[model samples]
Target: MPKFAVVVCPHCKNAFIMEPGHKTVSCRSCNKRLEASRLKVFFASDDFKEAQAARGSVVAGISGDTAAFEEALPGIGRDVMERIGEDVQEQRYMEDKRKVNEKMDEEARKTKKKGQQAILRDTFEELAENGDIDIEEYWKKISFSGIDRLKFDKWVEKLVETGVAYSPRFGYLRKS
Candidate 1:
């Protein structure tokens, strides 16, 4: 038995484990074979460094006084900052929804199901009618095994592909 760490294939971009003593493995994404020695280990320490670098880059890019935004506004209490944050979040949500709709429209033009479209349509319709669809709850209701999340995601992708469901501001919504 050899120790292994999950690595993303540079050639195909698929995630695969790098087993010790194995020099190469086929990528699950593009099926391109990649050398294990070329893979980079993304450990917690590496992740921390990456986060720190990203934060530093963002801070460096901002020219104005970042502290000014942190100060409390006139006639508003501590909740003012929270409210602004919420508003910004809502804007981001709307932007993301627009992008999803565009992606769904594009996917609908494609001619193939990729094997999960029917199931996805049923699930999306059910969720749209109910106005709520928690992944865990859906799994429980359907009696899915632990591995079913992958299947569910695939189905969701198909639904998106067929333009039957689009993740909007609050949750998944059907195209009207």
Candidate 2:
């Protein structure tokens, strides 16, 4: 047989019924997250009658009457509370780390794009001033600045994309 117990959401002070082992539920009234494991169950036994008198008041155990409720609710152990705290802290830490990583990745992409734009600008200026695409001379000009020949080649591709310059022959650039 399905058993039902009167329980209240610890988060929102909303009273609701729950199965004995239903460990999570959402509050209908406030829509706040409710830990069903934290829900105080009402026992039909007379031993709990005095404790259940002010049902709503005792529901959350946060309304300054927690000592009596804790004495009655011995099933919720100290370790469980500790584990819950640790879990919440760990979850927050992981979320913070993920946000930091995403920000770093975005910043890295922006930096790389800026570097590429700088390379494009320098290559364009060199080509414009020289008017003749001496590919070797251009490499020698930028080599000491740590720009490799392959990097210059990629920038030359960008120049071709700009429609202001093109390769009329292999190893040569001509103004268009």
Candidate 3:
């Protein structure tokens, strides 16, 4: 057989076979124009095919005859299985890291929420005790950091909704 080349389009993910003389081809999936001149194709030799077959049979003996498993073992089935095992281990490690990050994020959110509520409550109590409140001055005295802007806005909105804060002539006042 003449050494035909197979090209897979990255944009449309279509696979096509081309002969030696063909310089360009279009992808069937996206119907987009493509140049086949730069396409590179690699084919396994007969020796490789035999090795793959032997590996497949050995894997079959271990895993039993599953159609999906058989279909996956095209060449170097043992190497494929070893790679899959490594991939699974890496995936598990990544999943554990993901869970840890999620937990840390949750804890940080809770701490931030609690601190916001405490600040709001303390500010209200101080104004009430003094019998004179300056909204701008009070806000200026308070500091908010280490909190995400969106989360902080949400917390402030919740306080306003619950009558914990209200707009005054100057800026904002705490509800008594």
Candidate 4:
């Protein structure tokens, strides 16, 4: 097997492992043709895996990540790899949580635009106990619906006109 060499491309500065003895090699990143003999070699090894590790170190160094470059060196241990796996998992978890929150926000916006008075009416219906809604309780529950008292009164008037609800007394309303 031809011994592999870890080299950096002069044009793009990206590192990659390649075999020696070739007259020319194309840079993996920039695709520029370079004379193999002229290219600066960072490391050379008979083992392809060792050359790959050296290439990783060179790439990490080029990216300005010191920790990753150090991890690419031999005798780093499996604990570092495990930590990288955990970090990736945590990133994915956070991304998933953000997506869920965005979806909930979108759903809330759709519900908010559906019609405030309609939501308030539904809330009033839900607030009704024993088939009669206490005006005070209904007002308290629909506070978040953004419907003002005048608007609610007009809506209630419309409801009574449309035969959907009726005022049984001064402080209670019931659906007809």
Number of the candidate with higher TM-score, 1 or 4 = 4
The 0-to-1 C-alpha lDDT of every candidate, in the order given, reads 0.49, 0.59, 0.54, 0.73
Task: List, residue by residue over 1-176, the lDDT tens digit for candidate 3.
Answer: 44444444546434445455666677767877776666433222235444344334333423435454446456555664454434333444665698899999999989877887777567657875765456545555454534455654565567668876665544555454
Which ranges of candidate 4 are over 4 A from the true structure?
75-176
- How close is every model to the real structure, measured as TM-score? 0.26, 0.41, 0.38, 0.41
Tens digits of per-residue lDDT for model 4, 1-176 = 45998777767767788899999999988999999999776667787877777677666666657688768866434554344334334544665698899999999988876778578767866765469887777777776768788877777678778988889998778888
Q: lDDT rank, highest first?
A: 4, 2, 3, 1
TM-score of 1: 0.26
Error of 2 at 105 (Å): 1.2
Tens digits of per-residue lDDT, candidate 2, 1-176, equal 22555555545545555456566777777887677777555422233333343233334343444455445444544653343334434544665698899999999989877776676567657675767677776676666765667877878787789886888888777778
What local lDDT score does residue 59 receive in model 1, on the 0 to 100 scale?
26
Greater-lDDT candidate between 2 and 3: 2
Clashing pairs in 2: none
Kindly list the per-residue Cα lDDT of model 1 for residues 90-150, writing each as its tens digit: 5446656988999997786553343244445555567667775665555554444223567
Compute the lDDT of residue 118 as modeled in candidate 1.
47
RMSD of each: 22.9, 9.6, 8.8, 12.7
